[model samples]
Target: MSHIVSIQTEIRDPVAIRSACDRLRLPEPVFGEVKLFSSSATGWAVQLPEWRYPVVCVVNAAKLAFDNFGGRWGDPKQLDRFQQIYAVQKATMEARKRGHSVIEQPLEDGSIKLTVNVGGAA
Candidate 1:
């Protein structure tokens, strides 16, 4: 049996966030108050590539605050990629935790295909 899952990503797990950052080769997230433009936010600060300010993720509230300056400060694609990879890493981790086996394939369209076998050997 198989299933298709659509995830609306809300970054709340610090471990998963770290895993995603590692997978993307980005800098580790720092937990503290960060300055974003003229404002400030407190959370785990993830520095996206070429971004002027780091994205602050309030894990407890499942919220993210950032100042992109309408793509001038950073490319939205980087954030999108981060979200996608984060979702994949989170799902894969949960599946494996339940003794499921997972296989990942990177599609040509830049999307990933994760095949999970439930109750299967790792």
Candidate 2:
């Protein structure tokens, strides 16, 4: 009924993972090399729990894949939330890497806009 979707994220640093968790405020511990969940995954996985089929993370691939047990790849709402937080973290990391300062501003419509400033003349 469910499906597996591999989400290739820009998430490289474990610290970014911690920040994402903190930003979303997950209820339980979703850490370590790998983990599994029954509800909507806040962390990441790519396995369907079953009696007829068994799946597991057997390789060390640096990625964040979440299992969709809701008969879909994932819940749109939850995935959006994850994307929002992940966007900020990823943008910030890239901005800093390019020698720019990243600033996040919350808009009236409840959307965050990232502004990067490369100081030099302006």
Candidate 3:
């Protein structure tokens, strides 16, 4: 049996955030109040490659706050990629905690496919 899931991502786990950053080879996220372009946010801040401001993940609120200045300060694709990887890492971790195994594949369309095996069985 198989299932398909579409996730509306909310960055809520700091451990998963660190995992995603490590997977992407980006900087480790820092927890504190971070300065944006004209405002400030408090959370785990992840700085993407070539981005001017960091993306702040308020875990308790499951929200992200950032200032890209309308794509001038950062490429939205980078942020999207981070979110995608974060979702994968988070899901894989949860599945493993429940004694399940995961297989991941990268698709041609820049998307990842994850298959979870129940009870560690293929």
Which window of 10 residues has the lowest lDDT sum in candidate 2? Answer: 49-58
Order of all candidates by TM-score, from best down to worst? 3, 1, 2
Query: Cα lDDT of model 3 overall?
Result: 0.96
Q: Against the true structure, what is each candidate's TM-score? A: 0.95, 0.51, 0.97
lDDT of 1 by residue, 11-110 (tens): 9999999999999999999999999899999999999999999999899999999999999999999999988999999989999999888999999999
Task: Specify the poorest-scoring 10-residue window by lDDT in model 1.
Answer: 1-10
Q: Residue 48 of candidate 2: its Cα lDDT?
A: 27
TM-score of candidate 3 versus the correct structure, residues matched by position = 0.97
Residue 65 lDDT, candidate 1, scale 0-100? 94
Please provide, for model 3 over 1-122, each residue's C-alpha lDDT reduced to its tens digit, 9 standing for 90 to 100: 77888888889999999999999999899999999989999999999999999999999999999999989999999999999999999999999999999999999999999999999996
List the lowest-lDDT window of 10 residues for candidate 3: 1-10
Q: Per-model C-alpha lDDT, please?
A: 0.93, 0.50, 0.96
* Cα lDDT over the full model 2: 0.50
Cα lDDT tens digits for candidate 2, 78-114:
6556556766786677668788786678899866776
The CA lDDT at 83 in model 3 is: 98
Give the Å error, residue 1, model 1. 1.9
* Model 3, position 122: C-alpha lDDT score: 69
Per-model C-alpha RMSD: 1.1, 10.3, 0.7
